[model samples]
Target chain A: MTGIEPLAVAAAGLMGIGLYGFCLCRHAVRRLLSINLFGNGVFLALILIARRLPDGPDPVPHAMVLTGIVIAVSATAFGLALVRRQARTRGDDET
Target chain B: MTALDSLLALLLLLLAARCVSARSLLQAIVAFIVLGLLLALSWVRLEAPDLALAEAAIGAGLLGVLLLGTWRSLPLGHGNERIPLPWQGLRPALITTGCTVLAVLLTVALHQHPEQAAMSGLAALDQLDAAGVDQPVTAVLLNFRAYDTLLEMGVLLMALIGTLMLDSPLPRDTELPARTMLPATLAQLFLPLILLIGLYLVWAGAYSPGGAFQGGAVLAGAGVLLILTGFGEGDGRDGWVLRALLAGGALVFTLAGLLLIPVTGAFMAYPQGLVTPIMVLIEFSLALSIALSLLLLYTGTPGLRRRGER
Candidate 1:
C-alpha cells in the first residue's frame, strides 16, 4: 500500500472543495470560480499522470492541458459577460 | 521535498476553501488569484514549465483582472447576500460523502497505471529530429495533432464573437479620483520589455518551454497593463483591421493545412526542408491573433484606441 502522492491528494481535495462551493454558493461569479477550481484540479491530475510515463513526461497531455487552459479562460470570460448582461437586464426591468 | 509538497498541498486546500466561503466578494476574488499563482508554482514543481507559464499569465493574471472588473460592475451587495442552501441539513452531509468517495476512487485509479499500447510521448521523442521542433510539446501541438490545434484556434475565435455579442462592456470609471503619474510611468517602462519577452517566448517554443498560447497571454498582459494605466481604452467601432487580426490565426492555419496538401500529399504536412520556416510563420501568426483576441476579451469591446486618440 504505497502512499498516494501529496499533489494528487491536493488535486482531489481541490475537486471536492470546488464541488462543495459550486453546489452551495448562490452567486454566479462564485459558482464560476468553483467551476474553474474544479477545472484546475482536473488539469493538475492530468499533469500528474503525464509525469508517470516510463521514458519521460508525456507531451501529448501537456499539449492538451495547454489547449484546455486557453479554452477554459475563454469560456469563463464568456460566462462573465453573460453574468454582466443578466444583471443589466434585471436592473432595466426593475426600473 | 516531500514535506514541502505536503505543506503546499495543505496551503492550496486552505486557500481554495477561503476563496469559496469568504464573506466579502473582494476577499474571495483575492483568494482565488493567490490560489492560481500557487497552482502555477505546483506546475513548475511537477516539471511542466510550459503549463506554469500559461497558468500564471492566462489563469491567474488575465482571469484575475477580468474577474475583478466584473465584480466592480455588478450591483452593490450582489454576491454578499447569503442565500440559504437547499436541503441545508442533509445536502451538505451527502455532498461531502459523495466528494470524498470520488476522490478516493480517483486516487486508486491513478495507482492502477494501465499499460498503453502506443506510447505517444516516446514516439514523439523518437521523431524529435524530424518534427521540426526540439520541444516535444510543440511537436505534438503543431505537427502530430495539428488539426486539433487548428480547431482550438477556431474555438477561441468563436468564444470572442460570443462575448462580443453579449454587448456588455464592463462599466469603467471615466474620471480617476486620484489620478497619478506613477502607473503610466511604470507602464511606459515595462511595455517594451513585456513585448520583447512575449515575442521571444513564441520564437523560443521550438526548442524551449514557451509557445503561442503562453506568449500571447503575456502580450495580452501588456495590453491589460496599458488599459489599467489609462493609456488604452476600448473603442466602439470595429475596424476591418481589427477583425482581420482577430480572425487571422485560424484563417492562416486552415489555409496552410489546405494548401500544403498538394505539395506534401497530406494535409498539414510541411515539406521536409521547409518545416522549420513554415512552423515559425504559423506560430507567429497564431501568437498575433491570440494576443489580440485575449486583449479584446479583457477590454470587453470590439476595438481598441490609445488614450487621447481622436
Candidate 2:
C-alpha cells in the first residue's frame, strides 16, 4: 500500500522474470544478461530496504550494495572471458 | 504509492523483462543497459546517491560497453538455436513459480520486521568520529569492513591472471580495415570529456556516492574506446609500468595496512588523525588498478601494447 511496498513487489517480479530467463536461455551470453538482471533485482530490493531508515539513509546497506556492484562486474568479466575462450576453442576445433 | 515511484518501478520491471526476452543478443544487451539505468534511478529513490552513481557508471556504462565489445568479437549469429524439449517451458515455469513464492514470503517477513535495528549500521554510525571521514559508506568500506575490500582486490587479481592464462596467442598483425562506425574527429572530441568525467567521479567519491569502482569502470570504458578506435590495441602483454599501475592499489592498501601494525597496534587501522588521507590515497590507487584490470579483462589479455609494437 505504501510507495516502498510497490517497488519491492516490482523487484520481486523482476527477480522471477530473471530466474525464468536464466533457466530457459541456453546461450552463455543470454544467461549472462539474465544473471545481471537477477542481480539488479536484488539490488533494487536492498536499496528499497535502505530507504526505510528514519533519520538518515542506512550507510551499511549502501556500502554493501556498492561492494556487490563491483563484485558483480568482476564476476561478469570473468564469465565473459570464459565464454569467449569457449567460443574460440569451439571454432578452432571445427576448423 | 507515489505516482513517480510507481512509474519508475513499472519502467524498471518492463525493461528487466525485455532484457531477458529480446530475441537478438544486441537488443537484449541494450535492454539490459536500460534496466541498469532504471535500477540506478531506483537506488536514487531509496536515498542512496552513492549507489545510484555507482549503478550509473559501472552497472550501465562500463558493463554496457563490455557486453557490446564481447558481442562484436564473437562469431555472429551462431548461438541462438532454440532447444527442442517437451519440458522446456514447464521447467522454467515451475522454477519461477517457486522462486516467486519464496521471494514474496521473504519480503513480507522483512516488512513485518521493520522495527528491528541493524547493529552494524548502528556501530558504523556510532564510530563516525573515529573514521576520519564524514561519509558513512566510505567509512564502512575503507574502515569497518576493510578486510573484505582487501580480499575482493585479490579476487580481481586472480580473475585477471586466469583470463591471461586462458587467452590464445595473439594473431599476427594484419592491416585491418578501419572501423567506420566511430569517426576519428568524434572520438577526439569525446575522449577528453570521458576522461574529465572519470576523474570528477573519482575525486567526488569522498563525500558523495561516486567512488573508486565507478570511476575505475568509467576509466576502463575510455580505455575500451581507445582500443576499439585504433588508438590502442587489445594486446595481451603489458610493460613494467602498466603492471605497476595494475598492481598499485592492492599493493598500497596492503602495505598501508601492514605499516599500521606498529603505529596503531592493529592491521588496517589508520593513525588517530590520518584516516581520511589514508583512505583517499588507497581509493585513488584502487581506482587506477581497477580501471586497468577491467580494461585488460575486456581485451582478454595479460597486457596491452601499442599497435605494431612487440
Candidate 3:
C-alpha cells in the first residue's frame, strides 16, 4: 500500500505465475513464452529493487536487464527455430 | 505508488496471465504482444526510459512480429487446436503451490536487503567521465564492464548460429502480397523516418535514454515491416557479407580488446586519450551488427538478400 510494495508484489506475482505456467505448458513454443514471462518478472523485480535503495538507482542492474532483454529475444528466436526444425524432421504436430 | 502505477501493474499482471492461460495459441500470442507493450509502459513508470524504448521496440515490436510469423508458418489450425490440459495429475497443483510459496518468501526477503549495499552501481556512476559517455548506463555497459557487453554480443552471435544450424527453410512462398496503395505508400514514407530514428537512438545513447540495443531493435523493426508489407523481400541466401554483419560486433569488440592489450595493459581498456573515438567506433559497429542479426533472425533465415530475380 505504501512505498513500493505494490510494484514488488506485482513482480513477485508475475514471477510466480510465470513459474506456474512454465510447469504447466507442454508445447515448446508455449514454454518459451512462459520462460520469457519469468525473465521479465525477474527484470521487473531487479529494476524496482534498484530503485528502493537510498541512492538514486543502480546502473549495473539496469545494464544487466538491458543486456538480458536482448539476449532473451535472441535465445527465443533460436529456440523457435529449433522447434520448427524438430517439427519438420519428425513429421508430426508440435506437442 | 500513484494510481497510474497501480493501474499499469494490474494491467500487466492481467495480460501476463492471459498470455499464459489463453485457450488458443493465437490468443496467447496476441496477449503476449500486448503484455510486452504494457511492459514498456511499466518501464516508463519505473523511470527507465531506455528500458521503455527497448521494450517497446524490441520486446513488443520485433518479438511480436517474430511470434506471429512463427505462428503463421506453422500449419494452419495449429494455433486453434486444443491440446491436453496441464500434466494430468498432482504435478500441476504442486507446482502452483510451490511457486506461490516461493514468491511469498522472496517478497518478504526483498524488504530486508540493505539499502546502502545497493550503492555500488550508483557509486560507479561517479567515475563515468573516464568512460567518455555521458550516460551512466552507457558507461557501465561500454566501459566499466565492456567484457560483459562483449560476451552479450557473443551470445547473440551464438543464437544466430544456432538458428541457422537448425534452420527449416520456408516452403518457397515467394508470392508477394497484393500491394495496397495506402499501406505501401505509408511504408515508403515511414521507412526513412524509422531508419533515421534508429541511427539517432544510437547516437543519442551517449548522453540520453537510447542505445545500441534499442536502436538496433528499431532498425530491425523497420526491416520486419518491410518484409511483412512486401515493400522489401528476403532472398534467404547465405554469403560472407551477412555472416560478417552477424559476427561483426563480437569480432570487432574482441579484436579491439586484444589489440589494445599491449597499449593499455588491460584487455578491454579503451586506452588513455582515445576513449571517445574508440567508444564511438565500437558503438557504431555494435549497433550495425545488432540490427542485422535481429533483422535476419526475424526473417528466419541465415542470410537475407533483398528480393530479386537472382
- Number of the predicted model whose lDDT against the real structure is largest: 1
lDDT of 2 by residue, B18-112 (tens): 77767778888899898888888877777887788888877887778778767766788755545322245777667767867866875675456
Q: Please provide, for model 3 over B9-112, each residue's C-alpha lDDT reduced to its tens digit, 9 standing for 90 to 100.
A: 78878887887788788888898889888888888778788988998888778878778777767776654534333455677667767987987876776656
Question: What's the CA RMSD for each of the models?
Answer: 1.9, 2.9, 2.6
> Per-residue CA lDDT of candidate 1, range B1-310, in tens?
8898888888888898888878777788899999999999999998899999999999999999999999998898788745233246788778777877887777676666666733777787789899899998988988888888889988889888988998898777688522276888898899999999999999999999999888999999999888888887887779998899788888888998899899999889899999999898889989999999998888788989987686
Model 1 ranges with Cα > 4 A deviation? B81-88, B116-118, B177-179
**Which residue pairs show collisions in model 3?**
none
DockQ of every candidate structure: 0.69, 0.60, 0.60
Residues A1-95 of candidate 1: C-alpha lDDT, one tens digit per residue? 26768888888888887888888888999999989988888888888888876776888889989999999999999889989989999999999
Candidate scoring better on DockQ of 1 and 3? 1
Best candidate, TM-score-wise? 1
* lDDT of model number 3: 0.79
What range of 10 consecutive residues in model 1 chain B has the weakest lDDT sum?
B80-89
DockQ leader: 1
